[model samples]
Target: MRATLIEVAPRDGFQPIGPFIPTDDKVSFVEAAHAAGLRRIEIGSFVNPAAVPQLRDTAEVLRRTAHLEGLDAQVLVPNARGVALALEAGAQHLAYVVSASEAHNRSNVRRDVATSIRDYGEIVAGLPAGLRLRLNLATSFDCPFDGRMEEDLVLSRLDALLAHREDVEVGLCDTTGRADPDHVFSLAAKCLARFGARTRWVFHGHDTYGLGLANVAAAWRAGITGFDAAFGGLGGCPFAPGATGNVATEDVAWMFRRMGVETGVDLDALLRLATRAAALPGASPGGRVRAALADRCAAA
Candidate 1:
C-alpha cells in the first residue's frame, strides 16, 4: 500500500527559522512539492503577526497558490480568529492542533486542555460547508514538560475531542520525539479500534531520538496510511523545549521505497528540495538520505 504524504515544509518547516522566507519562494515551494507528486501540502498558518512574523504573509501565499490544480493546501488554525483568517484566505483544508498533556497545552497555547477542547467545538461549528478538517493531538505519547503520558489520559482527551467532531482526520503527534515505538503502536491500535469507523488516522513524528522512522512503521502496522512529514525535517514546536525537527520527508519516502510500500514521491526530486531547505539561513535541517546521497548526487 502507498502512504499519503503531506508536505509541511511551507508551514511547519518554515516557521521556526529566524529570518522570514519571501512569500514568492514559499509559494514556489508549494508548487515544487506538488510537482514532486505530493498532492497535500501545508501552505501556511493564520497566526498573529506579532507571534509568528515569518508566516504573516500566509494570505498572500495562499492567493498565489490558489490556481494549482489538485493541490490540497492545508492551513493550520489555532483558534476562532485563526479559523476566520484562514477561511478568508481561501484555505480549503484546515489542521487544528492541541496538546493532550495539560502542562504542555498550557505552555503551548496559553490555555488548559479543556478550554482548548471547548474552543475547538466552536471553531468547527462556525466553519463553512465542504471544508476539510484535520486534528493533531500533540504530545500524544510524551511531553517536554510532563514527560511520558499513559494511554488512558491520552485516550480520555481524544474521546473529548472526537465528541466535538468525529469525522475529521486525527493525527497522533510525537511532539517531543521521545515516544517509544511499542507505546506508539499500542496507542495507535487502540485509537483505530475505537475511532476507525468514524475518522481517519495519521502519524506525525519527529526524529529527535533517531526513532522517527521506527514509529512511522509502527503506526503503519496499526493500519494508518496518512502521515505528516516536513522536508529536511524542518520543524520544532516553539513551545516544546528540547524538541527537534520532524521526521524528514525524504527519509520516510526512501524507507518506504526500500520496503516496496510505494510512497509515490520522487526521491531525487525530493533530494534537491531538501538541499534547498538545508541551505536556508537559520534553518536547522535534519534527514539521513539527503546527506548520505548528497556526495553521490554531486559526483553523478
Candidate 2:
C-alpha cells in the first residue's frame, strides 16, 4: 500500500526544543525535507509567540517556502484568529487541533471540548471554498489530565465535527504516547469503517513508550494511509506532560519501504535531514535508524 508521510520537523520538531531556531534555519529545514520528496510539510503554528517563542517566525517561514514546487505547506491554527493569520500569509492548508479529553483541551487551547467544536465550526464555515482544513484530535488515545479516553467519546466528537463540516480532514493524535498497538488498531478500524470515505484519516504518534512504529503499523493495517512524523523523531506536546517527540520520519519511511509500501521519500536524504535537525541547539534526535546505520558503516 502507498502512504503519505507528512514531515512536521520544522514545526513540531522545533517547538519542543527550548532554544529559538533562526528563521533561516527553519526555512532551510523545510526546504531540505521537500528536497527529500516530502510533498506535505507542517511548517509552523500560528500561536502566541509569548507561549511558544520557538515558532515566533511562522509567518516568515511560510513566506520563505511558498515557492517550493509540489509542496503542500500546512500550518497549525488554534482558532479563528489563527485562521485569519494563516489566510493572510497565503496558507492554503490549515490544521486546527482539538483535544478529545476536555481537560486536555482546556489546558492546551483554553477551551473545553464543546467550545472548541463550536469555534472549529465557525472557522470551517468561514474558510474559502478551495482551502484545505484539517481537524486534529489531540489526546485521541490517552490524556495526561483525564486518563484514557473512551472510543465512543472520540467517535462522538468526530461525528459532531463532521456534522459541522465534512470536508475537513481528521488526524488522530496520541498526545501522551500511551497508545498500544491493539488499541490503536481497534479505534482506527472503527473510525475507518464509519467515516472512511467521508474524510481522510491521519495518524500522529509519539514514541515516548517505544511503540510509535508499532502503532503506526497497526493504524496502517486498519486502512489509514496518512501519517505525521518529524525528522529525528523530535516533537512533544507542550500541554501534555511527559509526552515525547513524534515517530521519526526516516524511521517510518524505512519501515514502510521494508514492508514493500511506497512512501515517496528518499531514505538517505531523510537521514541527512535528521542529522541536521539534531544538530540544532537544544535539539535531541530520538530516531534509531541514523545511529544504527552509523554503526553498520563503522563495522564495514
TM per prediction: 0.97, 0.97
lDDT of 2 at 220: 97
**Model 2 off-target regions past 4 Å?**
295-300
lDDT of 1 at 44: 88
Which tens-of-lDDT digit does each residue in 1-300 have in candidate 1?
789998888988898899989888898788878877888999889988887889999999989988888988889988888988988878899999899999998887778999999999988888889999999999999999889999999999999999988999999999999987898899999999987678999999988999999999999898889988998889888878888899999999999998889878988888888888878999998989988888633311
State the local distance difference test value for candidate 2.
0.90
Which pairs clash (backbone N, Cα, C closer than 3 Å) in model 1? none
